[model samples]
Target: MMLETAFTPFYSLAGGALIGLAAVLLMLTTGRIMGATGILAGILQPTSLPDWSWRAVVLLGMISGPGAVLLITGQLPAVQVPVSTIMLVIGGFIVGVGVTFSSGCTSGHGVCGMARLSPRSIVATLTFMITTAITVYLIRHVIGV
Candidate 1:
């Protein structure tokens, strides 16, 4: 069966390109790798003023990026988070633990690390994709979410 989906290819491609550009820009600007988990962890740990300063700035920029888009476009595409609050919290905890266990998050492995041609990142990204597929299948099909 042909899957005729309502996917906006333009926005998806643009967003992907932007993410790649941002990753490259971060590398060129600062020699540090642009890994969100690493950035947040670094912020949590004791470090010199300059070291954490950049992390804080990057994290804040990430947080504000959507707001900037909303201001420019005057609307954000509809996004419905279907999970309940308790499930959301639990999922967050699971993600946190996974990041810690994996030593990086999706941005780190899937985007930046893949750009850098790291084997571990390739493996991590594959694992993430597979696990996500399984989880989504279980939630939507099996459990009938």
Candidate 2:
């Protein structure tokens, strides 16, 4: 919790605001939804990319932000995964399935859809939140995993 007391609420809030701004700007500029799953899915398709340039640029921009910060500060965020590679892969697969079944990832429904007052998104977001809470409860409390 609190990244072991190293977390700063200021940075977290600012980071969230920046993400929201990026999502809004991307939508306004490109008329495309800014969902990571949707983007990845588009790239994975066999057909030629409709607008490969912007897709590559968006992906690169997302990557470069962290690289730029690392270069300037000579530090990366403290990240720790308390699971093995196999577990990580499994978790990722499960998340992909959920995204597919839900027709969108968290950002799609939680941020964009909710902002637009979509009823489907409202239900999807609520379902996702509740499921996440229950999973965490089981893992951390009951299962103690």
Q: What TM-score would each prediction reach against the true structure?
A: 0.91, 0.87
Error of 2 at 12 (Å): 1.2
* Residue pairs with clashing backbones, model 2: none
lDDT of each: 0.86, 0.80
- lDDT by residue for model 2 (1-145), tens: 1124466899889888987898899989998878777777666662565576677778889878877878978988657776569868988999989998887877788888888899998999999899989977877778776
Estimate the overall C-alpha local distance difference test score of candidate 1: 0.86
Question: In angstroms, how far off is 46's CA in candidate 1?
Answer: 3.5
| Model 1, runs deviating above 4 Å | 1-5
lDDT: worst 10-residue window of model 2:
1-10
Q: Which model scores highest in TM-score?
A: 1
User: What ranges in model 2 sit over 4 Å off?
Assistant: 1-7
- Say which candidate scores most in lDDT: 1
Per-residue lDDT of candidate 1, residues 1-66 (tens digit): 123458899989999998888888988999767788899988999489999899999999998887
